[model samples]
Target: MSLFEGLSAFPITPADPSGRVDTVALARVLNRLADARVDSIGLLGSTGAYAFLTREERRRAVEAAMATVGGRIPVIVGVGALRTDDAQALARDARAAGANGLLLAPVSYTPLRDEEVYAHFAAVAESGELPLAIYNNPGTTRFTFSRELIGRLSEVANIAAVKMPLPADGDFAGELDAIRSVTSPSFRIGYSGDWDCAASLLAGGDAWYSVAAGLLPVETLALARAAQSGDVAQTQRLNAAFEPLWSLFREFGSFRVVYVIAELLGLCKVEPLRPVLPLPDTARDRVAAALIVLRKHFA
Candidate 1:
């Protein structure tokens, strides 16, 4: 529960042009977030380009993150894969790497059914003793898990929590209410669409699985803490300060903007994998301007 109780950062795995995981850059990013004291760090999540990494590269990325975080914070390694066997293999590797927990989405090429989704997680659950968090991202996976399905999955012993994307049209509170009414009491839930994070926290969601925190961990932490502590004024102020950046995320994909933002801030030099382009130059310029203003505002 502690892993999903606060700000959990999902950072991109920095890679060189060779598509190899850049251990040095990866270390710097992980160490920075660890120093900032995020509740947890997720290795090989969507933001980390999990699907793009080879099995070997994914293993090394988990190792690099664990090495840098060094038990300073819990590491939740993403073990999602298109096939159940690959997912189990990654889960085995994560357990070997001493990862604290696992995150999984029902990755699919063709669509998957409710029972098949349950089986996918059940298969991986048998692979290791590490706890599991279901990542329900329908947009990318093209497979959605309804509340009923989530409830059924929560019945599995190690399936501890779920990371749901923010509900659209400002219905975060309503969505939380509806989901909680159906799910088990022991199952924790949180938001992942970073734009609605403050609202999610204020609405009593369990965590913020943040992409922005990849580069600005401390700043994002401040926002989560303010909302979590019921500091309405502070939360509102920080949310407004981030509004422009959030707007950019809502326009250009957050996946794209994060790549540009990291390069813009000199945190790392990395690019999105093929089929996912980096931000266009014009969008990058606007993001650059927003980052400058945000830095000064945060300063």
Candidate 2:
């Protein structure tokens, strides 16, 4: 299987109240994910709060994750920055730090054109030899990818996989089919925005870039395994069980909900980075209740 072709854990960067990336907390989270037997760990993905931290903090987080992983599994570090040069620099650093792969998003305050976006990944691909995954998260970056553009990008030599967010239109089964028709077979497909993972995977997509995997890897991996095994009946049953958590993701965003679940589970002291508050107590109570059902019946 491709390195990211299974459940790759995306953890929130655990920082202290002072906003410093707490290496100890990060190590604990990494080891937990490793023990869960994730195929890989993606550090500094948006879930990891890469945008909120300084470049130095990101480097430190990646370093900590690499040390903690100890080559037991592949580590893909995000090299996304608003500026192309900065992104290239981060990619170089990732290569130097011995990361096995790179993940980047078209993070921009201003809108980016097709050529500019292509250039961003191409420049970084030239900077280092590690494999790269293009992350297309329109909700967070306000940048979207047309299938045509993604096809063109897959031509870049080192670009390996694409991490896609399921569309708001809620037809990801169709979306995966559409994406596959445009991109080549060599360019693997992975979905993020975890709610629709079962549908995407059953539609023959390659992998899931999972938020829940870091916090609830065993539960999430069970669903992924069902999808991979072509057990449609089991996959649907598992998907039905997760609809409650999916509802919470739609209502209050996965970033908040997952951290609350992690905190309640005693996984880590997870709080969103600055400018975002913790989920309200009522929301947490709802998530706690859903998790109870999940653990008792589904998980």
Candidate 3:
């Protein structure tokens, strides 16, 4: 399968007020996304609060999402950790739990050479036994995979795709050309931090890993379909309808804004995770207002 061919929302792992996994809330979110016809559900991703979750919590989240989804769509589990062994263990657990694929990021707390990153991915690919998508979120890992490293990892067995978060000011075409140059013909390139879905699509992005889609899946899926069909007018219209929501990412963090919007849309019950802090009360009100406007426009 292609790396990220369809709509995938990174659902926040529901936590109770006491900070425990809230499976009931998680099930509700998954069912909502499935009802909206999202192609896949990504658990334990950056938005899912993976770093705060223990290994058991991660496993439980995967199981809960899989059970809730029940083969309706694929589940791509995020298996990122500060240690390679921990990440590998999570990958194995996710596979055993029946996840469709794995999203593996480089280990944090370590400055890895390009060769070391390749070797780490090589080991995880061997152990996971599932198709792997190399996650290149430099903001979190403090390391970005060079094109050379991507080329090496792409050659590894089971390494099927890449998730690249391009620098904001970087030359996207140049970066795309460099990645395309080294990756195999079958390797899919996913734009991880794409807020402007239409612009990214027009700029040659194959697919996007979207957080806004988590709140507005119907609109998000419509935009994705329009992009795939090369309907520029429709794509532009959809993007314009949701442009306010997309613009929030610039003023505030994406995950924080997404969580607030989720609660506003009644998709999730909890607030944003700690350390990240909840959106200001005024911001929450603005997001709610924007979402209401979007619902009407998209309707």
RMSD of each: 1.3, 1.7, 1.8
**Residue by residue across 104-204, what tens digits does model 1's lDDT show?**
98989889989899999988988967889999998889888899988888888788889998786778788888888877777788988887788889988
lDDT of 2 by residue, 123-183 (tens): 9888967899999999888889889998888888898889988767877678777877887
Which runs of model 3 end up more than 4 angstroms from their true locations?
Answer: 1-3, 167-173
Q: Rank the candidate models, highest lDDT first.
A: 1, 2, 3
Give the better candidate number (2 or 3) by TM-score.
Answer: 2
The collision pairs in model 3 are: none
After best superposition, candidate 3 residue 130: deviation in angstroms? 0.3
C-alpha RMSD of candidate 2 = 1.7
Please list the residue runs of candidate 1 whose C-alpha ends up more than 4 Å from where it truly belongs after superposition: none
TM-score quality measure for candidate 3: 0.94
lDDT at position 198, candidate 1: 89
How should the candidates be ordered by TM-score, best one leading? 1, 2, 3
Task: Report clash pairs, candidate 1.
Answer: none
Q: Residue-wise lDDT of candidate 3 within 13-70, one digit each (tens)?
A: 8886545788888888788788998877777888888888889888988888888886
Please state the error at residue 177 of candidate 3 in Å.
2.9
The C-alpha lDDT values of all candidates are 0.87, 0.85, 0.79
Residue 169, model 3: lDDT of: 72
